[model samples]
Target: MISSPDDLLRLAPDAKSLEAGRRLFYSRRWRLVGGDGQWLWGEWVYGSGQRATESAVHLTAGHFVCNCRARERPCAHGLALVLMLKNDQERISVGQPPSWVRSVQYQADRQAKPKPLKDAEAADERQGERLALMGAGVEELELRLLDFARRGIADTLAQGPEPFLAAATHLADAKLPGPAGLLRRLARLGRDGTEADIARTLGDLYLFVRAWKNRRTLPPDRHAELLQFAGVNIRKEELLARPGLEDHWLVLGTAEGQEDRLRFRRTWLRGEKSRRFALVLDYAFGEMPFERSWPLAASFQGKAYYYPGSYPQRALLPSTTPGGRPYDGLVGYPSFVELRANYQKALAVNPWLYAYPVYLSAVTPTLASGQAGLADANGEVLPLHPEYDNFFSLLAISGGGTLAVFAEFDGYRLLPLSVVTEFGLVKG
Candidate 1:
């Protein structure tokens, strides 16, 4: 069966493309729209009025092909074709796919085929090439960091953001997106951030560079972690082949963020018995098939195959079965002191873990000294993220009592995400 227009719209590269697809879906720009049992297709009279764009989507395999000059995949022509098949199917004639439609399937099958030994060797070679590329990028970055140390941050940042941005672009070109992101963050930090914040960012970048330089001496898991931080991808198949940690996992919370053109959501889960934390990160690019979600406060019995690392936080949950609510409501640090200690412990394990999830049971929302914060039973204050403006709603939920809170701890402050009260879960 074909997916709905909304589902198809989820993959659109941008709202502009989605709107364009919706318009194309109903417009009279298409002719001979048809489908067999397995494929939905159409011929769109696109910009070059003489050359008709052949748009086709596989009914079962979710493959889409369009013979058009559009740079993006599953372009508007294909999206509109699917919408037509779903919302206006009678307009589509029934027939087997022609040669052009079958070509997409052939490419998909070739790409999906397993060439274990050869692919592994090829991947290793690619990793080697990228690492070499990273070496050149890292050398220039080391010099930048050296300048910060010698010239002083005040003196260096006074020179402005150009140097930092150029270094970031070079790292990106080197295929080291992870470090590239850190460099960009530094450039954005500029002179606006506090002395502590700037120092911490520089420290993290320095340690990461050190980790990269000594990656070969690192243990297998640590080495893998380093590569990932440097923007190297470790395929799911590689992680799934590893033994998994079976547990009754509780959904701690979810957070969303956008990077460049892609939007991503991170679901934080913790094992009921194993006590291990797992992060499930999913990304969506308009018109791409990255539809993954995990319900909040739901319990799932599953085996999580973690990305190999010293901390082993992010993981791949290949499958899950409903396991009911966790033994009780959200359980977390008894006090702010304990939360800080635990975060420090985590930092000891992975110094680069800038943002870590911290849960607090029975914390009351408080506003004092012009700061929004959370207070544990003893009245110890943990400041809520400055950007968070949901305190009024949280206060309404609290009604002058304690509420369970889940927040991301970034060394100095807590960015409250969601609250669990007697009524239910409320995301901030």
Candidate 2:
């Protein structure tokens, strides 16, 4: 009663997933694959030690529920189940839906509840209580991460995003909001992100937990970075007391977005004399304006104090004076080769680094089938940010000729922010 194999293949996220589903249909590790008049259900087997997972699809609503680590919708298991119903109904055991199928059917309701914590102990602890709690929280997180790996990828799919999200309360108690945010991100991915997305986050959490356990061995600055990311806040006076860098800072670009009722803004700047990059982050409640204002492509004489870190970048400008553009030309990496090398060096010092601002020279804009990117002289292409919607405007500025671009690089993709061509500055 469901769609044909051709129609079912369309449900797969990509060709690889469709191929995988077809292979599962033929190789056949499926157990108890069955269908009731309104629903299709089956059991999928992983290798020897891994447990078999149950998957189901509602015929009328066309809903797919699966317990595999695969990130795609109607994953191999779901698609193969449909194929089984369509091709080999005799092999399927038709009957009333079992208890397991009925219980996990409404996946949204199957959240893993958070365990309780002893608030009295937390209240009594003193001196290094914060660190102690964080250490304990990190340990608990390590257990969950291990469980995720030991149980295999299908574990979360079988349970739902709740198991991953369950760590939030414990992390909040430990004052490790950053790690908690990462867990939330992982849970979201467990629900919707691809295998690659989930894997990257798992690796990040593992490294972060190990880093916390061995925090003492890290450099003093690196340790501060860890604390900074772990939701640690320092007094403004203390930060200003540290030596600040004074330079002619040029605003490269700024990006702003909103989530829920909170709006956020990030402005990036580069110093002409020091060639140093600085990021200023600000958050405002609904309809509120940001604290700092640095318009794009503007230059000013200012002193910026940076937060303590191995690769110090986020900075606060306490004061500024209107200034003209520098007499010297804008400096940038000659090619992607040097740019990547320097970026890797920065990442080596700060693995938790998010966006590394960069200036590149001698590149051309490229657009193919709705995708946009920049190409260097040697034909090396760095993709523009996936969310970028200013391709045509950027192309107009370049005029099919080479130009200099300022952007943010996040290890994998580049978010082109502004371009300086013969016509002047064009913010993307």
Q: Give the per-residue lDDT of model 1 (tens digit) for 358-426.
A: 888888888998888888989988777656778889888889889888888988888887787666666
How many clashes would you count in candidate 1?
A: 5
- Cα displacement (angstroms), candidate 2, residue 308, comes to 1.3
On the 0 to 100 scale, the lDDT of residue 25 in model 2 is 82
lDDT of 2 by residue, 1-428 (tens): 33555565566767787777778888567777777777778887777927787788877557677756554567787887777767777778878887777776545233333324774455456427878888889999999899889988776657878887788768978899888888877777776766777778788889999999889999899999998888887657779999999999888888887655878888998777888888988887765346546777678898989999989999988788866755355778878899899999999999988789988877889976766888898888887765678888888887899888888898777888888866666787
lDDT of candidate 1 at residue 283, scale 0 to 100 = 83
* Every model's TM-score: 0.78, 0.66
Which pairs clash inside model 2? none
Span of ten consecutive residues with least summed lDDT in model 2: 106-115
